[model samples]
Target: MTDRLPLFPLNLVLYPGLVLPLNVFEERYRRLVRDLLALPEGERRFGVVALRSGREVGELAGDPVDAVFPVGCVAEVATIRPHADGRFDVVATGATRFRLLAVDDSGPYLVGEVEAMAEPKGDDAEVMTLAVSRAFAEYQRKLTGAQGRGPVELPELPDDAVVLSYLVAAAMVLDLSDKQSLLVAEDGTVRLRAELSLLRRENALLEHIRALPAVELLRQGTAPN
Candidate 1:
């Protein structure tokens, strides 16, 4: 079913189950937050779409619809603390995925017509989940060591494949486009497979250059270690 939702264009991607904290200082977004707050507890939500190309603050150039990715996650408000100066500190969790169908810019903030998306566990979800868990653990260790953080205590990976997929997608320090790809993946198995490949690639690069960022590693064309 399709529904209308308030839209917030951000520079980052938010996967289902991820927790996002926002400082609402922008006038338009403040209005969005106020509107959401007026709704009942369970009904407060806004769509968070990753900006394709544009600043998160200020005015978006050209068309607002063209500035963001069509795929987005609904942020369900958990807590809202309003400040004396009209600013708000809000904590929300990613609840559901949605596909933006159309944008109405007539409002103070962008409002979108969206259709909710379903997450299916595709073929070989169990097998791929195991593989991804192992790969991600190693990737986490290497990433921590490379950042001069020494050893890391790997968190226990979630057993549910869908949860695992979103956890890795949200936790990994990947580029915006890469993270968005994971968000828009067809199913749990597909997301896990993509993450496994990404982990291997990142792990290889981290082994070669123990301290450089992934962008630098790519630029330098460093071979796998």
Candidate 2:
């Protein structure tokens, strides 16, 4: 059976085992925050879909929205602060993965009926967590050199395999599609491998860009010589 859940279409994708902080300022999303807060704790789950196309969430205006992938992660609000302007600052933690069924038009915000996807069990979880951590460390090293500084220090991750997986994935500079794929992955091993692949690709691209002659890059409108 499909269960209805509030939807938030974001330019970026969210992954399971990650915590995302969002500024809820738009009218519809603000309303979405309010509605979730008003619900009982168990029913406070919401779906996040990476918007593939279209500029605005509700104003598709006959333009095609890149079809939302069926798989997404459900998030539960972890922390919420109401702003003076009636907006919200919310930190949401991924809870479970879900597959979208249908989107309802009769709501202030988009609503979708989704089927929850079960997580995989076993020993590979630890292995995957380690892989993600290793890949992330390498990615960070490259990114720091490219940007000329390291990211701010983050909290230490838990020793538990599951929590570690989420923590590492959250810290990577993954784009929306990559994050979404991680969210829907059946197990930590799968997610970790995917993240590592993305990190490698990004590093390779950055190296390639860095190899170009400064003057040539400038001519291509990329950088100043």
lDDT of 2 by residue, 1-225 (tens): 578888887666666666777877788888888888888876677888776654555554442224566777788878878999987878887787788877885767778889887766345667766766666666655655566554645344465555555555556655566666666666766766666787778777777553322221001111100
Question: Candidate 1: deviation at residue 34, Å?
Answer: 1.2
32: Cα error in model 1, Å: 0.9
lDDT of each: 0.84, 0.66
The TM-score values for the models, in the order shown, are 0.92, 0.73
CA error at residue 151 for candidate 1, angstroms: 2.2
Q: All candidates: CA RMSD in angstroms? A: 6.3, 7.4
Q: Which candidate tops TM-score?
A: 1
Model 2 scores a C-alpha lDDT of: 0.66
Per-residue lDDT value at 152 in model 1: 56
The candidate maximizing lDDT is 1
Pairs in clash, predicted candidate 2: none
